[model samples]
Target: MHKIPSSEITPEHLFLSRRQLMGSAGALSVAALLAACGVRTPGAPATDTVPADARTDELGDPLNSFEEITTYNNYYEFTTDKQGVARLATGFQTSPWEVQVGGLVGNPRTFALEDLLAFEQEERIYRLRCVEAWSMVIPWVGFPLRRLLDVVEPRAGAQYVRFETVFRPEEMPGQRDRYYPWPYVEGLRLDEAMHDLTLLATGLYGRELTPQNGAPVRLVVPWKYGFKSIKSIVKIDLVDTMPTSLWMALAPNEYGFYANVNPAVAHPRWSQATERRIGERGRRETLMFNGYADEVASLYAGMDLRVNY
Candidate 1:
């Protein structure tokens, strides 16, 4: 297993951690107020949260703490490499990096990353499974994708959401070779896109995203393989139909859009039951949704995930 750096808490990381500190505390207060008002908040059962609920491991992977997201990842398309993301991405022009939301929206508009960041971004420490077979427990820093969708106003016909990565091959060497379709494209079903678990991330390890890790912006889908969470995006197009995903287009049977982590629905050449955590000890059995089943299983209620997967 890869040795995860210890607490990778930088000065910026510290700031992000502090920000998470504030945000979570704020959320707690709100949830408390809602309870007082007889309203329900979406989360786990415990008013007294437990560390086990968000642990990313063998039998009990948990949601991310602020510490996880700001520190770990392998989003190279955003930068040349993960380490480069730490240094080069600092110069990233986030203000100009806007998300061109179009396709199936009532009013298609471009949203700047800066503005999007203003939304209630939180840290979700999820089990990140890369197509390469390695895994990581990442605490991604971002807000739910559904919040953005609410603003875009998807038309009733919108059934799929397409994500387009930055296409400036000159700036992104990976694009030059067309290792992918220049701009990496990924799609999600409407309900999946609207899931609270889905995220549009901007930071990890408590700092602004490093380019190596898909700087500027990226997507996080806990239920799917890592490839589905594209980085350095430039556009988000919603349509009545499904768009192509890199991994799925790369290998149909192996990578599906509904790439839910189910122990029963094994990858063509791999087992979904086990996983290797980034910077951790040995590989361990992966639970459904990386152990977030209790929190997210109902989202797929009555659906044969194994078939779709």
Candidate 2:
């Protein structure tokens, strides 16, 4: 794990102004500061040198401020207001959490959050492209999802992995909306779930995940849109067929099972060709699979992304 220099760490009072400081510090200082703080630009490869074992495919710009990352989030369980979800999530409980892994698996079992942490952890800084045309570069800490799947041992019938988020109406006000689906659900092909880039994130920026950021555990599939990375996950089921995801069920034409970031395939409502970085001034061109095409393109093979998406 890389540590930021104490002198370079932004003070609490200056937390809100960190973006301004980075923007004004010029390229040289910004590079050093971003590297120290684990932030990097998205269009280019990671500027900092991590340990060889890290296996992080971090590319592009410096990271958004921790404040920006936490405050500006889309955990619909709490609320749709990105700035308000954090406050609304205070009542949510993450402890005493156990993720049930069943379905088409040989050893169906429920693993506690602590048990999930027993495996070797790796840090991966990934670019998160939202379906709404926004993006962020986040440094996440977690082990590969495959590590957990391997323990349960998928049966021959298992072809897809379905994930379910916790549902507590009292704590999650959005449940009352009756518009969007509750207990947010998401799924990925078995191979996609087992990919090295797929992570069951427990923390970000060297800190444990906060309530708004999906405390306890969440999925982080860098090659797909941010929503595909469901939050506050409670159950992971290995199924024989493609699972119905919340968004896909609500609006299949807009959201697909394989929500891979593709500039060519625009969303029904708007173009996905460009995305506005939260703290940045303007939008930047969206990349193919958010710039992980080189590593994950082959997964699609001859399959048409337009159809799968």
Candidate 3:
């Protein structure tokens, strides 16, 4: 766990300005956002560069620039376009939010946004590997999902956890499309949900998350493909049976329930052997369990990852 230094964190003024510029400019390109915020455009010489060794994760991968992390996103609830989410999500409401935790729990309760924030927050620099062969090193601020789970103790026979994102078709235009299911949902095995590495992320880069980045709260399971870390979470449920995730329901042959990162198990359309890290030049070999096999591998002891994935 490499702690990010204060100097490496994005300056507050620049973060605010970036949001303001995006709101006023309306659907500007990511390059335009970077240039307006005085950040070097991708592939250009950086005028303000951090040390090569600074702001790295445990694997020593340098953190992606704040611009790259925020501007480049895969929030399907907003749109399928990666860079367009930021613009469309500018007005998505997050405050006054509540997350209901129930279903086979002893002390079922709904936690308000402020209540969720009250938990002791810490920064965990993590590598977010998308299933589309792209990746980013993000410094997320939040506590373990287990902390919240403990509050609503899982009763006996609870074997899985289900997560659902908030639904507002009026604000989220993509949800209005009838082609796919609305109110995205995901799930994890009970033990996987309790793992210390499973984080309910609230913010990134030392700032509260923006709508494009899953504002208010979201899940961050570092060892799994990025989609498993569901965004804009509003409901959590403990169940005795495996929950059918949105992706799994949509394309069962393509997406699986486990969703653990395994370089050997390729997606139906492409190989998962290598991924392009944002802000980096070339592709790098994908790792088993996203390089956290040592920590999470035992969770699937004796099970074939290729089959589960």
Candidate 4:
């Protein structure tokens, strides 16, 4: 019921740094022009189409069109090509989906799709920065992961959380070709899993998640690169030791266990100093912890980020 406050909303006259409005047009007119052109500051959207009741916070950048965000994505289970993954994911069924929680927990259980949705939902307009240097602003509908984890309380020794994606080569074409590996896996520290910001997303753009975008359920950790938020999750296991992520197993040098968004720590293949926002024209300076430093900074105090990354 409470709305999450965001950064001060920049006036329309100030939103466009790349292009200056000519003449003595009033600031309100500049705002209208930008609205007509579908432009906003950077990470937030100018016009948030999501219903006011559904939203807990408004992003500063304009929301990417649903078509652009959903159709253009990286779901390796379907296909490697961004344009092709959406079509390939259509064959998968999600209505009766179940998520099994186990390992080092006091009460392990399997929850049906509707069961997860029974909890209250909130809309969070988050900046999804990809490891590949592209990003998008998405309005995700879900509840804090801590709510679900509480149902299956972690034991004292549980220090990490491992996630597994559904493995179905028959339905997912990429799995058949042995792209990266079948049944994509990812993990996070127990603290990270319980973070208030972490979400178990069920829908986006005010609707159920499409198969291509990890239908049924998925993890959304805004501070880390997009890959840390695994898709189409089927299992969550609390473990004493850190779990191996699909990207870490595939290329540990390029991807790290923490995977926090840091402009200072560059991926082996590319620099992390900047990111290209999808549908936007240019790159923006990458922020520390993807602009969530105030919220999650204390989680990693003495540890060197450059090495952990």
All models: lDDT?
A: 0.72, 0.86, 0.90, 0.86
Over 1-309, each residue of candidate 4 has an lDDT whose tens digit, in order, gives 966564566666676752455343567688898785566334333232443333322445677767667778898888879878877887588878999999999999999998899989998888899988988888888999999999999999999999999998888878887657668999999999999999999999888888888998999999999999999899999999999898999988878899999999888878999998887666899989988888899999999998999
Candidate 2 lDDT over 1-309, as tens digits, reads 998889997788798688767777787786787675554333322223232232334553777656667777898888889878978887579998999999999999998989988878788888898998998778889999999999999999999999999988877889888898787999999999999999999988777788889998999999899999999998999998899999998998888999999999988888999998776766799999999999899999998988888
Please give each candidate's TM-score.
0.71, 0.81, 0.84, 0.81
Local accuracy of candidate 3 as per-residue lDDT tens digits, 146-253: 999999999998999999999999999999988877789999999999999999999988778878989889999999999999999999999999999889889999
User: Model 4 — which ten-residue stretch has the worst lDDT?
Assistant: 46-55
TM-score of 1: 0.71
Which rank order by TM-score, best down to worst? 3, 4, 2, 1
After superposition, the stretches of candidate 2 with alpha carbons farther than 4 Å from their true spots are: 1-57
For each of the candidates, give the backbone clash count.
21, 12, 0, 8
Q: Which pairs of residues clash in candidate 4, taking residues 3 or more apart in a chain or in different chains?
A: 43-61, 44-60, 44-61, 44-62, 45-61, 45-62, 45-63, 46-62
Q: In model 2, what is the error at residue 51, expressed in angstroms?
A: 21
Question: Candidate 3: minimum summed lDDT over ten consecutive residues — where?
Answer: 44-53
